[model samples]
Target chain A: MTFSTDIHVDKVRALLQAMEAGDERCTVEILDDITQIRKSELHQQLSELTKNLHQTLDDLDVDTPVLLHAKHDLPDITERLQYVLNETQKASDKTLGSSENTLGLLEEVGTMLEGSDEVSKIQPLLDQASQELTNIMLAQSFQDLTGQVLNRVILIVTELEESLKALIERSRHDYDAIPQKTQSEAEQSAEHEKGVGPNVTAKSKLDAVESQADVDDLLSDLGI
Target chain B: MQINRDMNILVVDDFSTMRRIVKNLLKELGFSKFDEADDGATAWPMVQSGKYDFIVSDWNMPQMTGIDLLRHVRADEKLKDTPFLLITAEAKRSQILEAAQAGVDGYIVKPFTAATLNEKIQKIFERVAEKQNK
Candidate 1:
């Protein structure tokens, strides 16, 4: 194939130079012959390309069973992840709820003691308990943080399922003619989805403005 | 600048636990008259009824986010000047700016102490008081 293409290419170059050098009569005749030769070569290359594509597709078909099995397990993975999120949320709520109730009782006890003349005896201990309960309640805000992080993972997994399905479907199509998306296109879509969800890592480079004061300062700098 | 303990306040969050936590903290701060909504969509009509004296909302909700509620409230002539506070885990600079531009009275990041909530609410009231005095 390469030898024939090289011969055709040398012949075409010689013909073009002849046409450029004022040889007009035979140039059209030989140019038409060269066109036919180029067309036949293109047809041969196309057949080879098609054969290679079929071969790749056959290889993908061999792996289709594994892909299908993986796809089948994705939903179960999603469900288990959801279960973790829900259970953790429930535990967090129960712990925080009970702590709040205890804090409420402690507050009442402290108030009653404050109203009494015997304020010095157990007031410190009650105050300490109140502070500790408040800390426990604050700590349970971990549920919201964890939930947000889990939701981001769920988003990624959901997108992965779609990609996997698309890959499985690609095996059924003559996909060589279709233009695949570039890496930058995928990156742009990912960027659009990024930075909005919970900062799972407190040290995330995307948004390190951890405290409310920093939020205020940033907004203030933006002149909001 | 003092918060009126008896004034009606609406607490909006998608999570029931968050609403409960905010309400508990509010109770600790002596604000008892409370209405709870699961999301901003539910809170909008309640705010429009002119019953809520203050609004403390979580930002990342399902139906309508806290920013959307803030926009709706700010757009309404009846509720434009309502003291709106955002209690959210969204710590991004862009989100904070969006809420501020939507006329949020204050912003409190999540994992916050009851004391922080109290301080932010107090600061909002103080600013409102100063504006009215002006």
Candidate 2:
């Protein structure tokens, strides 16, 4: 359905003209053949475009997500990235504070140990060090929180990749043209026990598997 | 209600760092015994083993999600009574309701604090005590 230079309007008109003059059987056969050839042409053009775009992305050092951002006119990711940076900084500060407090307690204990004969005098400092260590442990929880946030960001980036890939593949007349199998096919080949990744954001989630025909039809309407 | 500090606990999350963090937090709260699995797939077998008295799991994982694991645990007669707490970043009301219907003992949204976890665990224990008293 995509309207491209490769469609060859003259060739299509010739086929239609032949169909009009021929017997019913010959007309049906010629129409089917023309349709198949058009499908193949669309696939070829799509594959070439995808290849060129991929190479351009590589040359520019821009990933598919960046390309998606450009195409979608997405908001800057700087704020999200900045949030991560801030959290990490706060966690590090908490960790350093706890560690330095523990260090001071240790030093006090060491001083008491050197000056006094009784071990009980250092007990209070040891207790304080233990509490500070616990604070350090609590501060360490930031790693997990930050990790989860980063993982969510990673999921977003991956979803962007999927959307971009899906868009490119959509230009093809057939879903089977991509070398990589569809998710369903991959699931079956893996015995259907393979787990899917986390759910993506609402927008990309819908884009994941829109029919190739629909995309081609839209492109055709746009005269692309 | 007095917490059973000796309870055998299973902490499930794909991230090892999260697992360790949760374990340390539990230790701070005076709970010592711990077991860990990276994902719900691995944790399912451990849950089935009937060794753990409590489960604290992250919702999003590679092999099986925490919701899937919770469903499995609830379906199994022996494991049904085990205190299962879900930790998730998902804040959708529908998901929260689904987890509740799936028989999760408690839900904790992520980037949670130690105080939040402790409070939820305490509440779960209180509910269990009330059920036992009834």
Candidates' chain B TM-scores in the order shown = 0.96, 0.97
Predicted structure with the largest TM-score when compared to the true one:
2
* Tens-digit lDDT string for candidate 2 (B1-134): 79899999999999998898899999999999999999999999998889998999988788888888999999998889888988765444445556666788777766678987898799789888888899
lDDT of 1 by residue, B1-134 (tens): 56678989999998898899999999999989999999888999889999988999988777888888999999999889999998887777666766777788888887788888888888888877888889
Q: Top lDDT: which candidate number?
A: 1
Model 2 lDDT at residue A38: 76
TM-score of 1: 0.52
Model 2: residues >4 Å from true position, as ranges?
A: A1-69, A72-79, A104-115, A119-224
Question: How do the residues A187-208 of candidate 1 rate in per-residue lDDT, one tens digit apiece?
Answer: 7433322324455432333544
Clashes of each: 0, 0
